[model samples]
Target chain A: MVYSISIFVSETQSAMKFGGKIGIVGAGALGAFYGARLYRAGNDVHFLVRTGFELIREHGYEIRSCDGDFTIKPPVYSAPEDLGKCDLILVGLKAFANHFLPEVLGPLATPNTVVVTLQNGLGNEETIAEALVKCGVHRSVAEASKQIIGGTAFLCSNRVAPNVIIHSAHGFVRLAEFQGSPKERTFAVAQLFLDAGISCEVRESLAAIRWEKLVWNIPFNGLGVAAHQADTAVILADPELRTTAVEIMKEVIAAAKVNGVDLDERLVADLIGKTEIMGHYKSSMQIDFEAGRPLEVEAILGEPVRRAQQKGFSAPRMHMLYALVRRMDQLRQSNLENSQSRSS
Target chain B: MVYSISIFVSETQSAMKFGGKIGIVGAGALGAFYGARLYRAGNDVHFLVRTGFELIREHGYEIRSCDGDFTIKPPVYSAPEDLGKCDLILVGLKAFANHFLPEVLGPLATPNTVVVTLQNGLGNEETIAEALVKCGVHRSVAEASKQIIGGTAFLCSNRVAPNVIIHSAHGFVRLAEFQGSPKERTFAVAQLFLDAGISCEVRESLAAIRWEKLVWNIPFNGLGVAAHQADTAVILADPELRTTAVEIMKEVIAAAKVNGVDLDERLVADLIGKTEIMGHYKSSMQIDFEAGRPLEVEAILGEPVRRAQQKGFSAPRMHMLYALVRRMDQLRQSNLENSQSRSS
Candidate 1:
């Protein structure tokens, strides 16, 4: 597993620096944005898109923002098999898509291929790390046991268009050793991202950053969704809710600190402020609410609070807000069910 | 003010038994229940009602519960002046109406009338007591209020039909003297209620009961409104939330203890359980939520928390919950205004 990961890492570094074939799996906002940027910088970028977004080639993606608009025609494919192996594969999607990712990424797994994940939240590394352990397999086992390279992508924001992702904001995208030591190839991959005008940080401590981001995401997103508000500002505008948000953030920080991140108040506050300035960024929470989707309540709100308690952190505010949001979500679900039953 | 209250007490005692007219202000649920029980037991009853409840006069007030329905008719007056002087007045309405209660109960007051309040939540006694002091009115206030009076009309559930109050669930009513001594007249009043089939308890320490009730109330009612859930059970159903509720109650109870009323944990739990059993009963907070009215957030959630904090009782749960519900109320108001503006 380690040998394969290193081989993949070397290829990523080579491809990123030398500007070779780069595949972006899950070409949604983050994927599309980074892919567009790399393509704009004169690198060959390919997108593995789902059926719904396959028409991106027909209608160009447009990113509406205060910043200047830029669009690009990165090659798009439905599956990795359609494009064969690439030097580096970037995975950008929601955490829930882990089950399908390995299969979707199968064709990109040459001996010298590396998968970089830019997905948010915790556990992506473990998923990818485990998949790499099962990399080589017989055809019968390959159907279920073939492993995929794990990658992490971190983007500021992307456009929601067909052909182009209007890159509005830029942030450092860190791809670390998902489960092994960073090789010379990893450093090259980081430099390649820089050469492509994408700020890339090769992290020795990727898990810490991922967990830190997750900590803030859970509270703010859950709060935004529960209140049916836009973002942190909508919640923070009220002093009490603001306090609650801070409290929740503190709990998250504590969880990370317990998990060995040692994030202080200042860093958490800065991250929170950054999130707010992403300006009208609706959290996945608000997105779910608007879509009437069953919220990621348990994972986003319950799990952290539960962990915090287990770690002996008195996360009073998180507990209260989590309960409040969970109950609200439950009510929303039951209300919908009632409405459906009545309509039926 | 003290002199007047004493004079009213003397007059009520002089009038004796079922002779003097009893005025029931805000003859909605509590008034209807209490008034009907008294009227049924042969006391002359008069009700002060607002517009739109004329139907109450014809069908009488009905209290429907598993226990059976009981109804009684007494004269109903829309305006305060329409009713003559009464020996006793029962103020049974929402706490928000306490501010304007003086206007409603003014005409019904004689020099020797005792005003018994059966309203829910904190500060009702203080409001009535302050009003009596300010107006230099002769009206005795009770520190403890009774849910039992409404219960005893055996009309656990009541619908006012015409001039009568129909009660369904007959239960015991608890009453106690204010901080001062329990006068002979207070006991006499208790006897009158008992004679009317309402089981009554005379509490030597009304403050403790009130504080105990307040501790239990802050968590359930505040959480119910903030969480937008129905009952105390919803708060308790989630173990984390229940622990939070208990923590909040402990703080409030500690504050109350500081204020001279020590409430044990068992009592708080019992009160919470009772509120749970009163299923589908929207708290004053929920009622305010539905009615688009300003909540008694201060009295119900804030004051206790504030007092607790002042008393060095760390009620983080209560404080946080208070802030959330207050914000929710404000946002709801803003939403109302925005919608109204759009409509206009």
Candidate 2:
């Protein structure tokens, strides 16, 4: 059951020992859950809020967790300028809103600041690297990417209300340096989550972990929405859809291999086997679709398909899924706009 | 803009002159429209009704056509046994309902009866041929195949009420013999439609015309349902979906080629162009999905994908669409059953 990837576990005893000003950007369920853990561990943590700024500032966050319930009224800022510079920045913005990264990170990032992106999908780290360069925090994308750590979260959480988060299950985080192998800071970041009682690991290849996550994400998340807001159980219940999911997983594995990140084909069976026991888990993409929010189509699907196609490898199923999900998102958005206009 | 297929214009002055007892099975919109036309043209057309048996038998069929409006009080039979043997049978059932063909056609079909399936997608003729064999009318499937002629209808019609049909536009039919090249009977069938004031032509190859229709149906119908009940306008409006439709069309064309039915590549552009001017056409599959009816996923998508794969060719996009549409149909049917059980 153990992954072949290298894992670095920091020998540090306390998250507070790593005295760094941590800035939490895009503090939704994933961001707030991890940030609250770090803040509770007595690390200096600040959160940048948007829609629920006033409510969160007045009432703070209520974390209803399966592990244990806790509340943290940590320092919250409405703007990046107010949040100030930090030694570490955690980016959890939806990939669709990644364009605001430069402006948001400009004031919060310094040359020495380590940016950790636990965002889903393929291109967040690259986007962060480009954002850093654009914001004049780094000389080049290479320099910016060096300071960035790409991580994937295996957490089941939802921001039910503006300032309320429900953490139901897994909270495992895998970290890898964006440039190459895990660096000292990568282990430090993994240690932060581990010290906060969250299962954590550091891998050698960012692409490996990302692609591994994608093996699960691409099919489950993609089909979850594309198959009319079907959950994991619904998908697995249908033999054809189950086979389709496996096919999509294989395509992803092949895509990763062609793009220089070799993933085990057994990951398909492993993920499916895990999902079968997971009950009727609605994928985040499916939830977002049901909630009428913009999907992370480009990051999760479009980028991977484009990358694979650039390598002269065709992933037709993935491409088809990308098209369906993207079109669905566009139609939903247009409908929302039309409704708003009509109401106005 | 002329099709290269041979046109068979009967030298007869009236459809009544070449009179044959015609049985219209599956008297849906398409069936009723064509049958009413033939009945009005002084041909003996009997309709086999299901859900609307009482209403249709009482009020007869009211045709509201773009061409012209008419009403016919033709003989309506509730069962095939009551309808008896026919000289010709016009099948306008949905492809998913083909399983009922054996029982339905058992009494209506004789060895001399020519069954023309105007149903959507591939395998309808095969189903009819097998049905004839199973019904003990034809000794063997090969022998039965000769009596089954496959026709693809280019019709825009909907049954608004049980006894009301709205034919918006287009009623051209392309007929081809199921066994091989067009026989004299195929031309006679085309003449039957032409005599009823409908545009009709006979093609040499059934596979060619069927695949040509699929070049339009597979993409438009499949995507129509798959893209969240999106109509043609919604699909064509979205650039990504439009491209996906074209890609699916190309895949269908390729599949047809691999299966020894060579469709022109230009059909892709031609279909898209025609669809552009066709307004917001809600494909039959999309409508069926909206109405919670079973989709023709197997016939329209699954059969073609299987045929192509049997020839060592992969139609990944089509396969993916097939999987999605099938899953959606299953979920919907299950939901309907659950609700019915609860209500009862």
Clashing pairs in 2: none
Error of 1 at A201 (Å): 3.9
Model 2 lDDT tens row, B1-344: 44345656566422334468999988898998999999998899999998888888888999999998998999998988999999999999998888899999999988899898899988888888888889899899999988888888999999999899999989999888888777677777787888789999888888988998999999889999888878999889887788888899999999999988877788788889999999889999998999888998888989998999899986888988998988888879989999999999
Among these predictions, the greatest TM-score belongs to: 2
Give every candidate's TM-score on chain A.
0.76, 0.97
Q: Which CAPRI category fits model 1?
A: acceptable
DockQ of each: 0.44, 0.72
Off by over 4 Å in 2: A1-3, A10-17, A51-60, A133-142, B1-18, B54-59
Once model 2 is optimally superposed onto the true structure by TM-score, how far is the C-alpha of residue B301 displaced, in angstroms?
A: 1.8
